[model samples]
Target: MRKMARHKDVSPEHLPYRRCVGVVLLNAENLVFVGSRTEGPEHTDSARPWQMPQGGIDDGEEPYPAALRELYEETNVRSVELLAEARDWFTYDLPPELVGHAWKGKYRGQTQKWFALRFTGTDSEIDIHHPAGGAHPPEFKAWRWERLERLPELIVPFKRAVYHRVVQEFAHLVG
Candidate 1:
């Protein structure tokens, strides 16, 4: 098996089957936080190429905690309450090239546990520095709050399905 990255130091099986968590943070303006990948080559034909703050769940960590952790790590935003979590996990496979060399043979892709949160604070709460706790820094140099329904049109194609589910689950928050 290939060794994973420095983010977590646990055996493969102990992890949640490529498990990850993400937060769809909703602000009072009804816009959701969306960010783009800063490091990878841009997709040529993607409809929307941004992604929400998300990351893998560490061994023995619950999905909720992971979701909160990922949100803080990816966006530097914190202190939001977890309002709800998907009853089931939403999964997506990484294109072969997206997988790191260490995870190539042993893992198929990622299985994400998604959550929805309401921002109790202001924009000053977001801290892009050391997002992902230094594991994965901000990919996009910029971020903005946008209508949640419009996200699927702005995210990478591979993530559009999950974005759809997010919108459906949080449709009540849409203006």
Candidate 2:
């Protein structure tokens, strides 16, 4: 079974099953941040699709904090002013291959808690290598701001459906 973190203030029953979190960062131009994954040897020369920053929640971590952490780790962007957060969690099942070996039996996939944040800081604030903290060393090699409505078409296939839903739910912020 996948070990999921539960908040101290909330009971497990109240939390979404297999919870994760994602950050949707919007700039003043109303463009959303999108990133290209570093090309692997197997995918060399192939265009890597873009995605918003996201990741799993750690034990005892809340969704919003996880979202902020992922944003910094993935894009080197921070100081986000949160605009909104989903009232309910969105879920998608991971393909079997994507599941960890120990979690295959209990989990069908992941349930994600999402947040929308406006970038209040200048572009200079984005540092893919700030020493304060972040997730991985940065899996993304390149990034740019794109129209929110077009994100569903630009992201990887696995994330397309959720991106579509997120766009719809947060369309008000885009305009």
lDDT of 1 by residue, 1-175 (tens): 2323433343444332477888889888778888766644324333355777877788899988888877877787776876777877777655444444324334445678888898888888776656645665565666888888888888777667877888888787664
RMSD to the hidden true structure, all candidates: 5.9, 7.7
- Alpha carbon RMSD to native, model 1: 5.9
List, residue by residue over 75-142, the lDDT tens digit for candidate 2. 67767898999877887754433334213334445689889999998887775544135545766767
- In model 2, which range of ten residues has the least summed lDDT? 6-15
Cα TM-score per model: 0.77, 0.76
Model 1: CA > 4 A from native: 1-17, 41-47, 96-105, 130-136
Candidate 1 positional error at 10, Å: 21
lDDT at 41, model 2 = 18
Q: Candidate 2: where is the Cα deviation over 4 Å? A: 1-17, 39-48, 96-107, 129-135
